[model samples]
Target: MSKPYSVEQPERSAVDAMDGIVALEFGADWCGHCKAAQPLIQAALGAYPSVQHIKVEDGSGRKLGRSLRVKLWPTVVVLRQGQELARVVRPADEEEVRRALATAD
Candidate 1:
């Protein structure tokens, strides 16, 4: 796993040796979209035991989010072997996240 540029974020290489299901969520704590999708994300993640969930508190000076080109809240990027597999933005459907996770596994 490659080390993250910021200490507040997880290293991408942390999930490189796993089953290839890494979910990186970029959002601020006060963002409504982030809070709204929590339950759905949690529920969908329940079905994927191997998925690595990384919640990044993104904002000004957040390198990880900037590196990923995240421009909105609650952006979930599903990665496999340090490579991007799927991306969900402001998801309203739990199935959307589930489907993304399914791709990596």
Candidate 2:
């Protein structure tokens, strides 16, 4: 079986492998939308497997989410060379994710 793409505890060095990044995020497992979005995040991410796909739980009181100005669960942010390309809040279609990734430069 292929390795599951989800990372429960990501290291800083690990994320550097991606020339671009897609962050699918929320605060915790208790969120219904967050649970639903996981599979979509995984499948959509396959198209850009070289892009770093990161799932961040926003409410560990970590500064990352705050810095990103996350205001909702299931937010997807695309970044290239560590710079923001696009952001979607609760996207319903995988195409939006794909489109965002494709736009990365």
Candidate 3:
């Protein structure tokens, strides 16, 4: 909710080097599925305020998304100390996101 999906995406290396809890949200602003899930994502993220959320705009030729093997809109990849902890793609509700975030704990 604090930051919108940004076109200026970070390099895969930077993301992989991040420490602590990180939520990488891969999606395009124009994506309907991404738009629809914003509220749900926001609500779930609210509980994990310490988690770093980076909304990356994903599409063809986007190295970060490609490296992560993102094939759908709003793919939320939770990472702990630069390693993957959990992933939720096209989440249907806030619970799905919350559950994914819970893995960090």
By TM-score, who's the top model here? 3
Which lDDT values do the candidates have, in the order given? 0.78, 0.63, 0.91
Better of 1 and 3 by lDDT: 3
Residue 37 Cα positional deviation in candidate 1, in Å, after optimal superposition: 0.6
Give lDDT tens digits, candidate 3, residues 5-104.
8899888788888888999999878888998899999999999999999999888999889998999998999998678999999999999999999999
Looking at model 3, report the run of 10 residues with the lowest lDDT sum: 1-10
Q: In terms of lDDT, which candidate is strongest?
A: 3
Query: After TM-score superposition, what is the CA distance of residue 24 in candidate 1 from its true location, in Å?
Result: 0.5
Model 2 spans with C-alpha error above 4 angstroms = 1-19, 22-24
Q: How would the candidate models be sorted by lDDT, starting from the highest?
A: 3, 1, 2
Candidate 3 lDDT (Cα, 0 to 1):
0.91
RMSD of 1: 5.2
How many residue pairs collide in each prediction?
Answer: 2, 0, 0
lDDT of 2 by residue, 20-102 (tens): 46554544566777666666666777888777666666664555665667788778777655566888777677787778777
What TM-score would every model get versus the actual structure? 0.83, 0.72, 0.94
